[model samples]
Target: MTRKTLILIAAGGSALLMLGALGFQYIGQMPPCKLCYWQRYPHIAAIAIGLVALWLPGRLLPGAGALAALTTAGIGFYHTGVERKWWLGPESCSSQPITGLSTDDLLSQIMTAPVVRCDEPPFVLLGLSMASWNVVASMLLALIWLQALRKS
Candidate 1:
């Protein structure tokens, strides 16, 4: 395939993923956790890189796109681990010890705690959570970006 085609596929994949995430948030009434938001930044960067790569004549932007995809994929893997209890997530969006806190402090903490916890998978499909899906998809997009780099 042409470099342009590969770029489009890579960038368009990120766009679709972002749209699905938004749909889950607004339409499905599922709020994103801290890690969920972290996974999105790289996709946004990849989309911008792809758009610029189309007009520019160099491998730099394509390489950046690949990096962006891989970054998001890594974040997705981390998020999956968090959801599976394999590792701890951020304290702000995950459970913490309630020990050694005054009653008022505990109550305040409870009130300020995030509604969406990173450790809990809001939705699962085919035994995999959304983070897992993001990892799969982002890796594929990264491959497309690499192909575009080669073509460039």
Candidate 2:
């Protein structure tokens, strides 16, 4: 396929993934955690790049789209590690120590704590979490972007 077509496909892929995520969150009643939310930003950026790539006459935008895809893929892997307890995650998203807190303080903490967590995957398929799937999809999108670059 031509580079233009590849870029369009890659961008569409990102958009579809983002839409699915939103569907899971809003329609399926699954709230996204901090890390899950982090994974969306790059896709949004990539979509923008794709839209601009259609009008632009160079490879810069498509290259940026590739970088965006890889960035999300990297975040997905990090989120997968956090889900599997392979390593510690950010303090804000992970459970924190509740030691030495008075009853009222503890109550307040629980009430104000985030409903979602980055340390666990809310949905999984065939033993792979959403983040893992995102990694796979984003990597594929990245490759498409790379192929577009090569063609140009």
Taken over the whole model, the C-alpha lDDT of each candidate is 0.93, 0.92
Which residue pairs show backbone clashes in model 1? Answer: none
Query: Which residue pairs clash within candidate 2?
Result: none
After TM-score superposition, what is the CA distance of residue 98 in candidate 1 from its true location, in Å?
21
User: How accurate locally is residue 114 in candidate 1, as Cα lDDT from 0 to 100?
Assistant: 59
The digit string of per-residue lDDT tens for model 1 on 1-152 reads 99999999999999999999999999999989989999999999998998999899889999999999999999999999999999988888735566999999999988986588899999999999999999999999999999999999
TM-score for predicted model 2 compared with the true structure: 0.87
Per-residue lDDT, model 2, residue 70, is 100
Off by over 4 Å in 2: 94-114
**Number of the top lDDT candidate:** 1
